[model samples]
Target: MTKILGISAFYHDSAAAIIIDGKIIAAAQEERFSRKKHDPKYPYNAIEFVLNFAKVKLSEIDHIVFFEKPFLKFERILETYVAMAPRGFLQFSKAMPSWLREKLFQKKMLFNLLKKNDINFNEISKISFSEHHLSHAASAFFPSPFEEAIVLTADGVGEWATTTVAVGKKNSLKIKKEIHFPHSLGLLYSAFTYYTGFKVNSGEYKLMGLAPYGDPKYIDLIQKNLIHIKDDGSFRLNQDYFNYTTGLSMTNKKFHNLFGQNPRDSKKDKITQFHMDIASSIQKVTEDIMIKICRSLRKEFNIPNLCLAGGVALNCVANGKILKEKIFENIWIQPAAGDAGGSLGAALAFWYLELNKDREVTNKDRMNGSYLGPSFGNEEIKNKLNNLGAKFEILEEDVLIEKTADDLSKGNAVGWFQGRMEFGPRALGGRSILGDPRSSIMQKNLNLKVKYRESFRPFAPSILRDNVNDWFELNEDSPYMLLVANIKKEKQKQMTEDEKKLFGIEKLNIKRSEIPAVTHVDYSARIQTVSSDTNKKYYDLIKKFKDKTNCPVIVNTSFNVRGEPIVNTPEDAFNCFMGTELDNLVIGNCYLIKKYQNPALKKDYTKNFELD
Candidate 1:
């Protein structure tokens, strides 16, 4: 069997993946293992996990690919500095030392790092590189259910390209167009993310979550001063109002002046109506740009299938809009659509494109529901729980599901850890905190007492695949929790005129739907369709929930506090359970209720991790 190993490191969300004969074996991110949010160090632990899971030594790997070519990235940095010379020397000087010492020679540094995994791994020639956008495109297309697709990838600058369009047919994928750095849609969203007092990469989702609370009042001003877009969705950023080209910050004083305020000091400032309005404006602009691009591409290529990747693809609202507009007959997005996914994309690109191998398409796509991380057997979980002095009872599969369903029906927040962990930013039932979606206070309690996050941030609904259409406006597969759709009008609770007049957070408390916890302020829900074919246990649990309450939906959020990476092991789950306000813990067939556990085990979890 031919084995390929892929690595994406030195950038945020470092990860590793292994493929055997072009079939993905295992994939995981460094943050999960390191317990650090967006860890950018070499994915030593992730690499080791994939290698171990695949049951192969690093030396046995036929080819090893890094996600992006360092030389090309270095060239872009140098060229960007030269073009903006004298004006950005401070940023240039600070960056050059690291580039010269480490990043410029990534292959050599990677070689040394690989040796830590296996001392016998000494073959340097096995190392290769894939372009960033190419990797993103490959990640979206290769494992997709489509045989041929128009691939669109947009993210912060990768080498030179910021936005790319690629065509993929069978085993062949080629880049057709590129909009290079300093003119990025991803950076534009991130600029708003920064200006709104949120962390850049980590906080973009928060900004997206806050968008529905306010009006998009600044779209005209944004279009006039910041970006110039054509009818075809091609656009350019007016860099005079930005600083990301050659500075540490994402926006400049001109950008602040255009908005009539300095960047909000996140530590001190409360999120006001202005922040919500700004979020709404940027989100609308982003949706418009993405829709325009999808429409233009569908017209230009006449392809029925569209595949999306990169950081921007994580914008579920935009994905939902593209779907709602019927721009493509079928759409598939990479579950791990950020830099972490680049590792798998790099490996797959080398397998299909580099090796010129034959392609095979599956009706259900080859991601295996994106549950590609580590899992523990019941015995292992029991042993770990015993070692931690945790109190628990092991039950039969039927009993466990029944008990958990009963807990949900009673409005208890349950820490549900089972099977393999998810590879993406989302917690797909596998590593999730679940609650009764019908509970009106579930969202507020989970955010403040459990997640220790902003109250306005929304939770997603994990609905049975068969029941998705009945409850939500969507009729498509959204197994990755990557599509937003409105709750069915019949299930929605209409707001009064006075309620509608309330602005920002004031509107958060009004229940909008039967599944109030998962529904957003605008009645939309980020939906994850659970299928028994992919995740039998999770599906079975939800089925039992449905049997009990006649509702197939549950509030599912990542199994961690805000700023913390999703739990990776039984120990991590236990610690988080003790730390948060979760009412019960379920791992494997084990169950532990909060009141029965040792009081000393309770933790001050709110201050456990730094805010994302």
Candidate 2:
């Protein structure tokens, strides 16, 4: 069997993944261990995790694939700088040193970093590069549950191409069309993200989250002045108004002049109707373009399923729109859906395209429920608890499941740590903080006390797979929690007149769903349904919970504090438990009750304590 290792680093969200044969073995992002949001440094921690997960030595790795072609990206940089020459002298000066010292010789630097990190199995013999967009496409297509799929990948410029359309069948894939660099939907959205008092790459989700609070009052102005849209839905950024292509700022003086404003400061909190309107307008425009692109892709390939990846696919709002449009019967999106997941795509491409391995197509292909990370066994858990000198109890298989379910029903936030931590951004029960859905105060409690995140950011729900259709509009299982569908109308709560008038984040208080804490203001929720076939332990817990409480759904958020990566190790989970107000943390058979945790643990966790 061929063993392929994919590495994406030196950019945002450096990550590593190992694929054995045609199935994914393990994948993890560097940020989890580094504790830096979007740590673009070497994925040494992530690489080690995946290697240990698969129990393979570096020598056993047959091939190592890196996402993006560094030389091509460097060429784009040089050309862009020359075109914008004197206009961005300061930005250009700052960009050059990093380019010359690191990015310019990315391949050699990558090989050396691997060696420094104990991966000294001669990378030169196995290393390969796929075009940036090709990696994105492969990421979308290879794991999808389709014999053939029309694939769409759009993101900030990679090498040169920013967006591309492709068709994948069996082991063969072909790019049908590409939108080259300097023109990107991602950069466009990022420009607005920068303008609206948010960090560019990091704050795109914040912008999307903020849009629902505002009306699309600036859409006409945005279309007429900021960007020019064609009949095909692809548009050009009015270069006169934006500077992101070659300047440090996302927008130019003309952009501020037109909008009658300056870029909002990151920490400033002067959000008004105008800012909200701008966010709404840009969001509408983005959804429109995505739908049009999907329609065109359907016309081009005549395929029923569409595969989406890149940073853009993380837009659940847009994903919902495409689902409503029904251009394709099904869509399989990458859960990581960012620069990190490119590692999986890159490795899969090597296995299928280069190694000529045959692939098997299922109703959901071979993602294995995206649960491909390191998992500790009973002995490891016992050792950790003993080392910490903490009190704990070991329960039998049935007792563990029943006890966890009982805790959830009693309104306790339980950290449900099980086999193989998930690779993608979503928690997916393995490394999940679960709570009862029926509690009206659960959302606020978790947001304010446990997660210490923005009160506006909503939590997701994990339901038993069988009962998903009973309460959600989605008929199929959403194991990845990427799709947001409306809660069943029968299950929706009727709003009062005052609640009807309540717009924006204030609307979050209304019970729009049967499980209010997991629902958003719009009566829609990101859903992940547990199935016995995928994760029997997690499923059985929920099954027992449902039998007792008559509610199959539970709040399932990733196990970590806000702005932190999900917990990857037992220590990380324990530390997170101490840091937050979670009632309990369950890893393997060991359960650490918050009321009984060590005072030494509580001392270190006091740094970011909050309670709702």
In candidate 1, which residue ranges exceed 4 Å CA deviation?
none
Candidate 2 lDDT over residue span 291-335, tens digit each: 988887787678998889888888888997798778899888888
- Candidate 1, 292: how far from true, in Å? 0.5
Q: What's the CA RMSD of model 1 in angstroms?
A: 0.7
Error of 2 at 332 (Å): 1.0
| Weakest ten-residue segment in model 2 by summed lDDT | 603-612
* Model 1 TM-score (2 dp): 0.99
Pairs in steric clash, model 2: none
Global CA lDDT computed for model 2: 0.83
